[model samples]
Target chain A: MAIYGVALLAGCMMFGLIIGDLLGQVLGIEANLGGVGIAMLLLIFVTNVIHQWGKLPDSTSSGITFWNAMYIPIVVAMAASQNVAAAFSGGLVSLLAGVLAVVLGLALVPVIAGKPEPEQDCQDEPATAVASNTAGSRRG
Target chain B: MFESLIELFDEYHLIAAFAVIGLTMYLSNWLSVRFTNGKFHGSAIAILLGLLLAYIGGVVTGGENGLADLTLFSGLGLMGGGMLRDLAIIATAYGVRFSEIRKAGVHGVVALFAGVIVSFLAGGIIAVGFGYTDPVDITTVGAGTVTYIVGPVTGSTLGASSEIIALSIAAGLVKSILVMIVTPMTSRIIGLDNPRSAMIFGGLIGTTSGVAAGLAATDARLVPYGAMTATFYTGLGILLAPTALFLMVRAIA
Candidate 1:
């Protein structure tokens, strides 16, 4: 678990750096700044997903915590070096694109097909409820 | 080494990058929670925001130095994350009870992966048609596309961070298109009614498509479509992941 956490954190950071550089060139932005942001976001998201999905054990939570803590500093460090004006301008474009995807995705998808059923609610509720109720009666 | 690191940051202008991306991911995640009813939808939002933040940061910082290096690294990172996420989910599902696994199951995983591959292939074809030949690699471009598109869209529509929000909405629009086209076919093949499957399927497809679009759009004008393609891929991935898995299992058995 510790290894996986480390791998995830380091991997995300490196990925951020590389992708940041590439995107910076492609879109005429800054590499380090992009790298840091990508790294932090990826690390947070990946770790959060593992936790949410119940894959990582409780003992490993600390590792994820450590990684999350590190993200702020790294990002801050990266940000300290950037051209604020350009960053904001490119950011504005990125921000606009990101917003459009989410809103349209949420609104349109549901309208067309409605939301997918929650997986948890679909199974085992009645049986578990019945079992608990019977146990309560016996205790009473 | 210290000097080099400091110089690198200074050259790149790291502070603005961090602020912009940090806020981008945060806002995107917040909007996702506000709008979506699904479990872990917030996490998805976070992931997208992170990617967007990274992409924008790279673009802003690279400036005259160019993004060649950052792009390569980001692509690799995205591929690694996608693979790790896939493996983790699959392994966890297998370890649990069969009944529990059935809820989302191996089929779902396979479908999602397959959808990603399919989307990538489709995107590559589109790229080829448009005269781009960067080798249709799914790892580097997949997640970035999703983040770039979805983060902006979700953030904007909710009146949060406009750039991130706009990206999120674009991603969603792209995903929706993919889902509308692919979900029914995948559903018929896998035999599941759950919309979650469709969502996963859509995501996979959208991610793949985003990469393809990015590669194809050598010019800046076409770059925006990268987010749209990813959104479409994701929507298809989420929707069809489960059904695709089921079909694969039956065929193998």
Candidate 2:
């Protein structure tokens, strides 16, 4: 399940990249390929943050912290190290455009994958209260 | 064809970095689950491991003048060193309730974007003050960009596994170098708290800006790789701020 989730997320990123590239070309913006990647990453990060924050789980928070502290820097470093001269000389814009297109192609996966609905709050309180009452009764 | 494949594998260090980071994270998580019963707090472990691996790999593959040479390693080391510096800054900021400076709702997002922008502007000013020219106008994807684009394209064009891996790794390393140089200064200037600062610093080194800046610095032969570092710092600010801001807004909303 975890592996599947990762693959799904990766697929979504690819799709998002594609959509972002097309959007960039339509808008005629430079570096839109990156823009798309940023957008996808942001979407994933924020959505995860929000979803997990709602749960207030320690594990999730730890995951978020790990991501913020470690993953972001790694991604930034990777992007920065490219040979910009060759990228430009070889029409990096178009190539990025193509990469973006590939990313966008994968966008449909999420729609089909179906995001889980946010958990309800009321489901747990009654059970907890009952358990506490039982413990109190036993103590009495 | 074989030579090209070998060269491609030798170049793109980002893939290797990613692999290292991923593996490190996996191992850390595995250890946490085993020892702490799933209570491992995130810290410098994974990043340090990734850096060590990249350094070792570079040394093994490129030898003395290879991508992991003295200058590049030192630059990367300095860049990583900044993370420790930011950890102190973050501790201080939290000590003073600095996170409260922004509205509670959007503080994290604001902090992240501000950090990136501040770092970029500061890094740029620093670069210009230090007499570094912007190597490639982002307005057009130039030679630098082509190496990344072409590396993948060439691999795909040639349909060779070695070429693909080499190009990816070369691309990654060059990117990492650039990010390392610029991100610390930018993050420091932006006044982000510890975790965000660390992440932004990492991100700056992770992208094409790192490679671009590194190569530009190398070409200009000014302070070895100063230009590349500056470019990575500034480019990150340019590239990431908007999305960060947007995410913050959404988070608050």
By TM-score, the best candidate is 2
* Tens-place lDDT digits, model 1, residues B40-72: 333334333333444454476553111212522
Fnat per predicted structure, each in turn: 0.01, 0.00
Fill in the DockQ of model 2.
0.04
Reference-based TM-score of each model: 0.30, 0.32
Candidate 2 shows a clash count of 76
Cα displacement (Å) at residue B253, model 1: 33
Model 1, position B144: C-alpha lDDT score = 23
Q: What is each candidate's DockQ, to 2 decimals?
A: 0.07, 0.04
Model 1 CAPRI quality: incorrect
In terms of docking quality, model 2 is: incorrect
Worst 10 residues of 2 chain A by lDDT: A101-110
